[model samples]
Target: MSQLGTLEDLPIGFRQGLTATNLVPLWPNLRGALPHGIPTRRTRPLLWRYSEIRPQLMEAGRLTPIEKAERRVLVLANPGLGLENMQATPSIYIGMQLILPGETAPNHKHSPSAVRFVVEGAGGFTVVEGERCPMEPGDLILTPSGLWHEHGHTGSEPVVWMDALDLPLVFALEASYCTEGEPQNIRNEPDASQTRYRRSGLVPWSGWMRPPTNYPLVRFPWRDVKAALADLASVTPRGEAVRLAYVNPETGRECLPILGFSAVQLRPGESLALPRHSASAVMNIVDGAGVAEIDGVQLQFEQFDTIAVPTHARVRIENSSSTKPAHLFVVDDAPMQRKLGFYEILANEALPPI
Candidate 1:
């Protein structure tokens, strides 16, 4: 007999033959494999106000010690993209880490990369490898993948920082691993790595002390960054914001291997034009109040408020005050996406370049 004209036309016994051989036909599922329209993601946009969560973090510090909890971080899970019911985002993992005075978050290293933006307090520091960098409000620190690091606060009050990681992607790929380092970081010298790697327009000579892929700088001091932003704000025309991307001093690459970091400033009465990209971004309001319209959703943000913009979502930023400027710190997985050939951008068709 001639072959059945189509899969559905085949007799029940013939259909069972295909399934039993582990060779099911693909012709019936071609449409789902190649859809006609752009795909939509399950992840959704959201915002978190630090003021509302600060008390909970404080309460956590009182309940758990660094040794018991290992690290006191409250994960900022994206409600829409909770994988395996763990409440993790699709691409990134964010949390507010707290370290009370006289406490030290133990040393450990993981396959996922991490970065921290200081929220408040002083005398708190991060020890990466051997060099210790004191973290103050506004400072940014890197903890690259597989790097030994720990946190401690010697100040009177608790030190809190917004922590961002690429662990969600790591978990998605099933490449997650963690290991404990020595009780203390190998090196205790303060600012040694910063002085060695972050000097102006210079890189330290290295015979055999470098890794295949790692950011050389341990800390990007807020003072110098703020000063440069202020200078740019003055010269860049009115109603324009100054944006700076943090790069590696050695190769001028991104600050982290998996993520991108940037600082943005919106001058008084400045409004950034709407633009969209393939990568989603989580923005922390460093100072000043502003309104960010993302995908037709309006978010009025104040200091310490965090707003998440989903992939390819249109965004426009506006500074609310006519006399004061707004500063924002942003983190995104653009580096990984770009490296994977899935990154695109529509950079400011309405306004001047940032």
Candidate 2:
């Protein structure tokens, strides 16, 4: 456990030694007061909780290190990695969570970049790099690492989303870095800039220049995904579904390296075997029930369900219900892996007819 210190003169904090968190005092300040302190000493501070962050939902307040441990942090990326390694590779880190109406999370930032893809609810938003983007249930807001950001709800409804970041990979490589700014909601002052930058990128026209903004884009409004599906209905299998992926319309590449996002709708009792190879993925059940056979794990899932499959593991998604369609979001690290030339897909063996 390395210590949490100033950006430069690293303080021996958590992993190393922690007389106390550096949230307030610099190392010299504590050293100057304690002659009893020896060089490179080790001391245990208060331990915090890191269980499933499900209990703190619907509540927002400033809690001490001990109390803050209880709050839910929807980390989407790998659980533990540092920034140094994550820089060489690509991944997201965040927990998918839904905040109740009127609740607000304070300001914070880190060395690994982050984006919030709202999974449910509406009316809450995230303020990033000096701009506030209305958290409209499905908008994708971002906070590039090193930028200040906060989340709050001024509207009457709750806000929910998948908190995606590269922290796990970062923290794993021990390149973990963090810097929290002044809390935003304690004052409740509205900033007009938040809404302006929520969407500052260019619409991909010819796979050319993508407009510049904090994050390139936020592809949501599931209705739009549905519309695209309808148009492909005649061409797509009625028993199965369609998944065209969210791409950099202009570049025709990927939104980012290591994270590929897409959604689909499966017809009632429809079963389709999707060939699989390199991309490791997680699927979230949004609207219906289904069975996902991934690497031998036949998982039956309903709404609010989550399932993860390893890369190159044989996989297939099937809709087991006969009454309704199943809608879900499938995320992976494929497109980027393709750019690295390490992408692969293993087709199911063709069986000889009996």
Candidate 3:
């Protein structure tokens, strides 16, 4: 590569004239804008242990009530991305939200899409667009953009869930905002997950003639996912990573527009090295314990722990138990990267595309 002329190389008078005219030279910062190979990334590989977060979150619940704090959340901010920004990655925002017994997180909706993965507790539920989805541990519920959603806990214990949203991207675009409204009267009907899209290959009989909806199913039960993973693992050869993508049943695409969600299962005593992809990702441990080696850092994680991986980083995950399989809930910005036409995966071995 050739050296580019810097602003300092220009005469002081010319630099002053350009500054006065509100114009700046591009050559000096061209490489910074378009790097030689990989694009610049600020996301760092980090781990947020549930053991460490739970205490602070519980303290937050004790300190703030539902009326005072609209959504009782403790953001899992990435130090590399600046904690004040409340971002896990450039495009993804993650936080641990809590709801106590007899409390309701009022009705509201926003521009950025969000998903809630239940970490613990039961008898908690989210009503999204009139559909009431029960919150059992490990269930994944969606609160898509422009939809009305709210949370409530009917159980005795404290209910906690991981909230993942595309807030950073929407906020950066200046389109991030929410509107509070009166609580919704949930429809007297079962959610799509229970009634319409129960099976993987089958849809409602009417769906064949009716126009497909973007989100036909918003709730994914962990029981179903775990069973599916078990079935997949039965046939999956050893040394292969068993993973399944969460997609829209009708369109067979990523359920959300920006982030991609998936469930990965690592067999007992398995150490899987994932391909270095151009999308940043976060992995939430759903079951069992494991040690994740990101780039050169090793992070030991247990159930409910979350691990963040930066773009283009080598990641190797090992199941710590020799008798039980480890399950992970993964969130990635691959859909957005692919839409922007820059998603890539690099590895020495031939691996399937993400």
Candidate 4:
């Protein structure tokens, strides 16, 4: 390939004239726009330890009341992407939110889809479109786009949950905004997680006759997911990764449009290398300790610690314990990449489907 001309190589007079007309040449910038191999990425492989964040999060609860700070949170920003951007990856935004006892986060809805993974404490609940879903450690609750959701704590202690959203993507498109409203009048019936979609491959009889709802199940109990992972691990081969994707029970598609979520389990003393993918991802260690090597950067993670992986990066995770399995909750932008027709996975050899 021929070397491209630099912008500075152009005559100053011509460059100034082009700038005055609000136009610039593309020849000098082609390589930067479309790199030879990998696409440019601003995300970095970094881990946030819960041990370090918990104290500051608790201090935030003490310093700010619910009224003053609606949904108090500390964003897990990637320094490579600029801290002011408030992004964990290019398309994903993650934060640790806190709610003290007797406090309530006001009802509001935004354009970006979001999910809450309960981290610590109990008796916390989120009301999504009038269905109150209780929050427990490891539970995954969906607050999809345009859904009115509010959080409250009834327990004696504080509750914290990890908030993952497609805010960066939506905001980049200039379509991100939230509307505050009055508290929802929670319905008397139980959430769909308990009634309509109770188990895998089983839905309400009525669902068979009608069209599938966009989000039939909003809350996935961690207890159920953990059990499912355990059952999957029993049959999974030693070299394969035990993973399960979260999907809409009725349609069996990803639960959200922009982001995808999954639960992964690493067998005791197992070190598994993941296929490199075009999408970026964030993994929150749900249980046990592990070491994750993202594009050659090794990060030590424990329960509740969060790690970020950039696009098209190599990743390997190892269970540090010899007697216990390690579980992780992962959030990724693969769905968005697939929608845009660029999702790809590179594997050296044939492997079991995840």
86-114 per-residue lDDT for model 1 (tens digits): 33346778889999889988888999998
The model with the greatest lDDT is: 4
Say which prediction, candidate 1 or candidate 4, comes out ahead on lDDT: 4
Full-model lDDT for every candidate: 0.80, 0.55, 0.92, 0.93
- TM-score of every model versus the real structure: 0.86, 0.64, 0.97, 0.97
- Candidate with more favorable, higher lDDT: 2 or 4: 4
| Candidate 4 lDDT over residue span 1-354, tens digit each | 899999999999999999999998999999889988899887899999999999999999889988999989999999999999999999999999999999999999999999999999999999999999999999999999999999999999989999999999999999999999999999999888888888778888888789989988899999999999999999999978899999999888999999999999999998888878998999999999988988778898899999999999888899999999999999999999999998999764433221
Q: Give per-residue CA lDDT, model 2, range 103-186, as digits (tens).
A: 667677778766666656667777665555666543445566677787777676555576656555567678978776786533
The segments of candidate 2 whose C-alpha lies over 4 angstroms from its true place after superposition are: 1-71, 74-94, 137-147, 182-214, 238-241, 350-354
Q: Which stretches of candidate 3 lie above 4 Å from their native place?
A: 348-354
* Per-residue lDDT of model 3, residues 281-337, tens digit only: 999999999889887788988999999999988888999889999999999999998
Best by TM-score: 4
Question: How many angstroms is residue 350 displaced in model 3 relative to the true structure, after the best TM-score fit?
Answer: 9.6
How do these models rank on TM-score, best leading?
Answer: 4, 3, 1, 2
Tell me, what's the RMSD of every candidate? 4.5, 13.8, 2.3, 2.3
Give the clash total for candidate 1: 1
**lDDT of model 3 at residue 182?**
92
